[model samples]
Target: MIRRLIFAFISIAISITIASSIKAAETIRPNVLFIAMDDLNDWIGCMGGHPQTITPNLDRLAKSGVLFTNAHCAAPACNPSRISVFSGIAPNVSGVYANNQVLREVLPDVELLPKSFSKNGYRSTGSGKMLHYIIDAQSWDDYFPEPASEMPIPHTLYPDKRPVSLPRAGPWQYVETDWGALETTDQEFGGDFTVSQWVSEQLAQKHDNPFFLACGIYRPHEPWFVPAKYFEPFPLESILIPPGYKEDDLADLPPEGQRQGPNRYFAHIQKQGQWKHAIQSYLASIHFADAMLGRVLDALDNSEYADNTIVVLWSDHGWHLGEKQHWQKYTAWRVCTRIPLMIRVPKNCPGLPEGTSSGICNQPVNLVSLAPTLFDLCGLPPSKVHDGPSLTPLLKDVDGQWPHVSVTCLHNPGDYGLSDNRWRYIHYANGDEELYDIAADRYEWNNLAADPKYADKLAELRAKGPTSFASKPEPSIQSLNKLTWVTLGDDKAPPSRPDGSQFPVFFINQSEAPVKLYWVDRMGQPKFYEEIQPTKTARQATRPGAIWQITNLQDKPLGYFKVDDRSAQAIIPAH
Candidate 1:
């Protein structure tokens, strides 16, 4: 009996010990407060890219952590850059180099950062625009405004009538590229402000497990419409043009570089004399974004998890306000590629037991390293498919040795911009190159690729670039190709002079009744294809010049669409 009792006591003790160890492990695991800013360059006060910019919250965050001064995005465009940041994949390998390309379609099997955290026993949650215009619900445990909506954004006020400040230059100009101040408050704005509020609520509560909370702030982007109070600090009369601009900046650039510069939007904005107004609006929008960030930070600092959470802040990519004679992103120049990156690790973390000290690191780093760095800091297994190395060494010590060169993928596969500590090299797909000694010329006003003395340096940087680039994935038939609907009058449908390569055209029947699909052949005669039910969609194989007609159930003419040189969607109008 004594032996049996001793054995039982030993078993109970072992069980209790195991439970305590597991509980202790859970308690020490660090929480993550991941924050993302959209189209935010180094204009914050900490980086000083623009003197008029006011970002007290951003500056405070920088003072509390390690700020990477030479960090660049994996891609310059939003869809590709955000995809690379979240997936730990580079745009060159993933073949997603543009905003229009769908993420799941291109790299369907790749696990996103939040999903990886969730898989490793963390509660991953987020709000606002984490992905390009999407929330990507399956990757998170729970999201604000409901995850089922698939759009993480809450309702925000926008201008009732667009083009409030800058007039539409042409049909080719993006509609959202306008700016003005709105007569409203942060509570009335309700976009990123709402996102911040929800995130603050999450941070206030205690969680059962470690949390990976992402707060995405969408501002300092386009349309630049924020509450009027943000614009008070930056008076229109005091607004200044970006100091990087020069009339002869493109004179020494290669053919591709010269061609990419001097865009029509900049010309139009200059012609309309709205340049200063645009700058003021941008500054205001940035101030608004900073205010939203302050809310989240305040919540975290006041919460129970304040001392144990890891805070990381990054932007998807930088924006251009007439830098390099360009107006928006999609360029490999430093103005568009370089972004603000800051990480603050608390004590008791696996990667840095002593925690991170406040300092700046000037090593060239890419955003693709973000996932792996978080994994290392949070004690999770490093992803097997990460393209960039972990940044834990730099986080631990700001001046740590980093030999990595940051590469920013451009619009195509073979085009890229490579950056190091002292140089910036741009390579276009058509064999044009531009090299700038960035240390001497921060604005990239001079191209030194043509200089024979730099030939060896050129070769060295070129060799460092990616050797193989995956071919761009073919666009799916469901591409967002918009077609204009011409309501039929007393005229007949146009002839289909079917020409060029064939592609699929998706037809959506948005009308209240069923519509008949007809192919207008070369003879201008309607050939019946099929009947499309209301609120249904169909695909039709068509050529570049093929004409399609839509008719009511009684065979009455409704509208017609003349296909362009690409596959598109033709929506039948509701009567």
Candidate 2:
């Protein structure tokens, strides 16, 4: 009888253990597939802004998810805008004031979105451009480098190209057209191929671990290169020109408010009177990107992960195709500031009704809110320091009154703008201000800043302060040139040590004046210094082809040194 009781007790214990394990297995974390597009505007069929553009895959995704129609970027430039989204910190606060500003310098201790996920045992992987011009290697567990050439073929076949050129300011270069038989699909186009393939492999692995995969598409940014097949859909003659520009349109804009200039491709079109052809190229590029997106979505559907994966599709910022005579971003116009954002949560997630789609929410939303929103969705703790608020409540109820304002900042000169539900107010550093009822003047052709009736409204917006409101901490000077000795040769010849354990650093003379040397970690963190000089008694340490940057006062490149080989090199100007 005692033996019988022991057997029954053992069986009960085993059952309890099994039950606990089963309950743990059932608690699966939802995976995230973050896809970002460059310079994509409200041209997709899902947005209903462009009539002919067919983004069926995106449309389907939106139908299954919540689409935020009024999404804007904290900054319109590539680096600042992307930094804002990824870091959840405002550009002004983060000190990422411009394209060249490194994010790690401002938030050294802050873990990036992917890094945070990785820390919590989620597998984080990405390919192509995500962070900025420079990818932060420390953020991702795996990163596939972008291809060197962003072309369908090696080079253009037609040498004597007769493309038109438009009058513009800023860096616009021209190139002749070259055709080749290397007709690869947009999926296999250089950098895109690696990203698409990586995503496919990740899905195929079907690991028990949850994954965070981000694919950054670089098309629709410049050159507008895509397969002829995609181009065939948008015939040159049928391509609609953007709303016509009138000379009086500039009447309301300040001198600085005028459109900058056209890019090389648009300039070529204007010179050759092939504006329709240029538009066709752009549309073709967008179509190609959309098709790439479709391939990934199809892969998701085929995989077991589809039902549980949360898909978020966002564009870094919008583009301007001759809207108000501008051909690129970096403007306060709707075509430049307004971006497309779509979030498709898992069907089983709370709040959203299955297959329910919400119409446009005209309330202002910025990309800076993306980090917090993702964290809230994934049930992660958000960082205490972020400029954006989560839109989870709004997603739960479409009519929820989650009213907030969005502000976009332009760098040093301090031109900034504020957008409420109905109006947009822009203020420049020179004390010039403009106000427009965006509901009525989406084009911003009429400025009400000078009107006496709207003085209160202007004050309300301008009271928010300059775009660059955050003050940067003073840089540390002592840690600028401090170095530790590293081994030179593989031989065990008593590792050479520098005097006072400090290594001698050399500065390349790229400029007529002396250079400033700063030390940054692999994560793109910056340490500023007044100047660095080689100590007479200090021995230079040998390191790999990394570890140094030499720059002039204006922050122009001077040279770099390979730490492993102790070799120095100079940077030459590209003619």
Candidate 3:
């Protein structure tokens, strides 16, 4: 009788200890490790999209968390997709439907994703292509290598013959097309690899509170240039035309669907016989991106906070490799809309069961859902409104019965696609429609909109799309007045005009806020040359030893620097 009593007491004590540990975990806020890959498609090894796709890091990450196989971007292009993900606002509502549209002007009131974390006492730091080439000054506590650009590298492999010196193709929008191997090491290429190293260094350090650390990788996007070592694995002979490529996929009924317009990128590759070489380059870039990911993941796993950090890796949107006769992501097809998304919740997180550390989710979900989902997982106060549903349910149960559907657009609301588990419905701006049973036709080879039997089903999915599209917002006049620059640095700086030529001056806005520069004209009077906005530069004729004042939009003096003979030929810090 005494032995039984003693055993019962020990059991009760163990229960009490577990309860106390759970209570303690509830009070501990977790850190966030967010990673983003640029222009990546579902060609990773985990997705099983391509046989030769080698992405061991991405595949391992998928196994470590719930990999959402059917995830889609809120928008297809870079600016809109990124804006939708960060701002928690859909392109239809914000009217930020295209690139070159400044996000601050479109959705000025929305609190960005990182800012919400900062509001809740978390330190947010990020590096490289995180914000689609523009940094949100109010969001981050600090950023590495400030003044972010689209590409981190100063030059590509072939800098001289940009846009490919080859003949015309696909409106030749930007000279972004073309690829080759560089005779250099990964350290020598040093764009995304540097970003990974910086992020890794942060993970190694200790922080006072929770953190939101972001690492952005820009590769495999275009000009697919990586070290020659990455190219060796994918031999030129083994490189085959993408499996999705069809001989004449664009022979369809709808005007919008048949609208190949000016895109000869596919034709250009075929004519130049560089299709296999291009494929090899893309695969090499993907491998390089995967290698960089390995570095970041290694740092996180070896960090002091390894057990308390939530890791998430996502791509902005997928690219097309001659799929449906499309080149880059601007379509509503399954290939263009789908992206790889993985989230690994830490064991120390409160209320989470931590059952099955790795699971796969196949339900269609929107990337815009990320903003609200992070807020939910971090135990922060929810936003006033998020355009999409949260993925908390799917996170808890990979096969959870989620009624939500995914929607994505190209450049406008009407030009969008609505996708669910079994169907893909596209409604273009010109009143053309296309429907496909995704389960039957994975390649989207046939359009089913003409079938009368599926009309009722089409109507149901169409109702889930945007109700009414908002008008595209116009650029502010201040935004339109772009600044022009001239160079002025010290010492080695060119001699200030002894021959009556004005000094070549650089006038870039070095502040987070917009400012105007004023200098004494030839008449010895202070006059406004131009209002230099943030990230904009303007140059004006000024005499040597002339003083220039930079003031905020409200005309408050921020700082002043002089352009003299010694400083004239030198870069001036105009903060």
Highest lDDT model number: 1
**RMSD of each predicted structure:** 5.4, 11.8, 10.4
What residue runs in model 3 are displaced by over 4 Å at the alpha carbon?
1-22, 147-171, 260-262, 351-356, 477-575
lDDT by residue (tens digit), candidate 3, 242-360: 77777777766488877732256766777888778888888999999999999999999999988888888888888887887667878888788899999988864643535236899
Candidate 1, 111-211: lDDT as tens digits: 99999999988999999888998777888899987899877779999999887888875444677888887888899989999999999999988799889
Task: Point to the candidate with the largest TM-score.
Answer: 1
Model with the higher lDDT, candidate 1 or 3: 1
Better of 1 and 2 by lDDT: 1
State each model's CA lDDT, in order. 0.89, 0.65, 0.77
Q: What would the C-alpha RMSD of candidate 3 be, to one decimal place?
A: 10.4
Per-model TM-score versus the true fold: 0.87, 0.73, 0.78
Roughly what TM-score does model 1 have, to 2 decimal places?
Answer: 0.87
The window of 10 residues in a row where model 1 has the poorest summed lDDT is 166-175
Question: Candidate 1, after superposition: displacement of residue 196 in Å?
Answer: 0.4
Ranking, lDDT, top scorer first: 1, 3, 2
Q: Write the per-residue lDDT of candidate 2 for residues 1-575, one digit (tens) a residue.
A: 99999999999999999998875545446788999888888888877656667677778777777777777888888888888888898766776656645566666777788888898778888776687755676777776653332221222222133232233221122232212112555444555545676777778786766888988876666656666678777766787876533435666677667534333444545665756666677777787778778778888989989887888888888877766666667776666777788787765443232422544455778889988887877767778977798877767765678668887877644676678778898777677777998778766778898899999988887775544467543323222333233322332212221112222343333234555554544564435544643331122343333344555567654443334322223221211
Tell me how many clashing residue pairs each candidate has: 0, 13, 9
Off by over 4 Å in 1: 1-27, 479-486, 489-557, 560-567, 572-575
TM-score, predicted candidate 3 vs. hidden true structure: 0.78
